[model samples]
Target: MQCVRPLWGLTAAAVCILLLLLLHCHMLREGQLSAGACEVVTLDRDSQPRRTIARQTARCACRRGQIAGTTRAQPACVDVRIVRSRQWCDMSPCLDHEGCDLLQNSSGWTCTQPGGRVKTTTVS
Candidate 1:
C-alpha cells in the first residue's frame, strides 16, 4: 500500500536519526569531540560584587589539582592558583592589618594576621 510505503520510509529516517544521535553521544563520551573548556568567572555574594569563582565545564574533566565547580552561569575548574590569580582578598574583607594569602595546596584563600591567626575561605 502507498501508506505503508511512506510509513516505512519514515521509520527508516527515524532510525537513521537515532543512530546518528547515539554515535554523537558515543563520540562525546570518548572525548573525540570537545565538550568545551571550563570558564573562569567572578560572582556576587552577600552584596559584595565580583568574587572570583571557577565553574565546571560541561562534559569535561579537570586536570590534577583541580575540582569541578558550578556557578549560575556555567561550570569551571577550581584551584588554588585560579583563586590567587583572581585576588581572593579583594573580594573578602580582612582585619585592619591582616593580609590575604592563598593556600598552597588547596582551593581556597586565607586571611592571615600578624600573629599567625588565619581565617580560611573555601570555594566549591
Candidate 2:
C-alpha cells in the first residue's frame, strides 16, 4: 500500500542513521577518532564586576576512562595510559614539598622527601 511504502522508507532512514552512529562509536572506542565532547561554563554575580573577564577558555570534557590532554598540539581527550606514558606529573602524584620522579617504566612514580630520600613508590 502507498501508506506502507512511506512507513518503510522512514524505518529505513532511521536504521541508516543508527548504523552510522554505531560505526562512529566503534571508531572512538578504537582510539582512531580524534573527536571529544566539549562543554560550556558560565559564571554570574549580583555584585559589582571584578577587574575584567577574558574572552574564554577551552578544556576537554572527556568521558570516563579519558582525561583532558593534548593531541596534535590541540586540546583533546586522551586515554589514561597515554598520559601515564609521559613523565609529566600532571596528576599531582606527590604531596606538598615532595618531589615526584617518574619510573623508568611507565608503570608508576616515586616520591622523594624534602631530605632527598625516597618516600614512597606508587605502582600504577
- Give the best candidate by lDDT: 2
lDDT of 1: 0.58
For 21-87, candidate 2 gives per-residue lDDT tens digits of: 9998998765543446543334443443443322323356577887765332234576776585674
- Which 10 consecutive positions of candidate 1 have the poorest summed lDDT? 48-57
RMSD of each: 11.2, 12.8
The residue pairs found clashing in candidate 2 are none
lDDT of each: 0.58, 0.59
In the range 65-85, model 1's lDDT, one tens digit per residue, is 654543322455556464546
RMSD of 2: 12.8
In candidate 2, position 9 carries an lDDT of: 97
